[model samples]
Target: MARTDTAFRVIAVPPARAFAALVDPAALTAWLPPEGMSGRFDHFDARPGGAYRMVLTYADASAAPGKATPGSDVVEARFVDIVPGVRVEQAVDFVSEDPAFAGTMLMVWEVTGVEGGTRVDIRAHDVPAGISAEDHAEGLASSLANLAAYLER
Candidate 1:
């Protein structure tokens, strides 16, 4: 079956602030990578139909193999939808030769105001078979934690 993973966290910030963190390329550069990885974007345009490409490099080369090159995974993505202070979505495709990883995926981020903070939910749709679900989930969780840390700072 095709796999889609979802993760959520509440941050101590308003929805507008949370939305900014999600959509701003600079903020993304600060917190998008999961633990043990770092990312750099080739270009980022946040408007609808805009596009971006990024390369994520593992801190340890051994950690990247079949899923990526010796040390990095490259992704080309487009901004699918963006609703200020509410939601953002992107269509993502990995730049890989392996058929198992040759597919376009969708990622959505929803931000809503809560009593004391903002509720942030992220959904990754149609994950490639080459990526382990457990590791992906951990990465998502780690990203959320990183975002929280960045926001709090």
Candidate 2:
């Protein structure tokens, strides 16, 4: 249903470093969650049409511990396009027979090499209209921050 998504842009210290951080598990885990949260890829195949899955854990909201999700959310995607250290596009889905995401979702990541690092732009289209834009935006912003932090280190 048309394109309804959030956009966030951030500069990475080094463009190549930013690209490298995305594919590395250690790097990925280091910066992929919001403050007070953590996550990592379980088994990621970054190639086109590859299966990508990641597990995210939220910290307890209070003094008590939190209940973790049983499994990682799985998405079925086909690499629609890829340019090494430059950009990537993937057709991802929720993997449910449900009509919500039974269709193709286009996730485009464009990275431009700048003087000091890189400017990255991400757009996820075909998102169900049912989801909240605020949540989506916040998640992506946190992820970008995480990515930046990982690269800086």
Candidate 3:
């Protein structure tokens, strides 16, 4: 069976602003990486049918080895659906030699206006078995926290 991981955060920004950050490579690189990791984009095109490649590097490889490389996790993602100021859906694949990590994961990011700000929801489906549930949950929470901090500043 496929696994799904979800997370949400109320950011102190409007839906449009949050949506902008989702498609902006610079903004994504600033907030998408979890704690103890940094990210860089090899290429980014934010539009339907467009794709992006991102490399996330762990600060301490000894603590957690990467899926793609010893210290980095490389991801190639295609934009499956893009609704400005509303939602962004993607098909993501990890660049890994391990067969356990070989599969496309569906990711949906939705932003809706809330009372104080915008609510950002992230749903990741078909997460690879190579990624532990606990680690995935922690990573999702960390990224959401980072997004909140980035937008609230």
Find the candidate with the highest lDDT and give its number. Answer: 3
- Candidate 2 lDDT over 13-129, as tens digits, reads 767777766555577668766666766655777675566665555565453232233332345456676778987787766544445445566877777887667887778888755
- C-alpha TM-score for every candidate: 0.96, 0.74, 0.98
2 versus 3: better lDDT goes to: 3
Candidate 1 regions off by >4 Å? Answer: 66-68
Give the Cα lDDT of each candidate. 0.89, 0.65, 0.96
Best-to-worst order by lDDT is: 3, 1, 2
Off by over 4 Å in 2: 60-76, 95-103
* Better by TM-score, candidate 3 or 1: 3
- Kindly give the stretch of ten consecutive residues in candidate 1 with the minimal lDDT sum: 61-70
Q: For model 1, how does the per-residue alpha-carbon lDDT over 35-83 read when each residue is reduced to its tens digit?
A: 8888999998998899999888889978656256878889899999998
User: In model 1, which residue pairs have backbone atoms overlapping below 3 Å?
Assistant: none
Clashes of each: 0, 2, 0
* Winner by TM-score between candidate 2 and candidate 1: 1
**Residue 125, model 2: Cα distance from true site in angstroms:** 0.7
Ten residues in a row with the worst lDDT in model 3? 9-18
lDDT of 2: 0.65
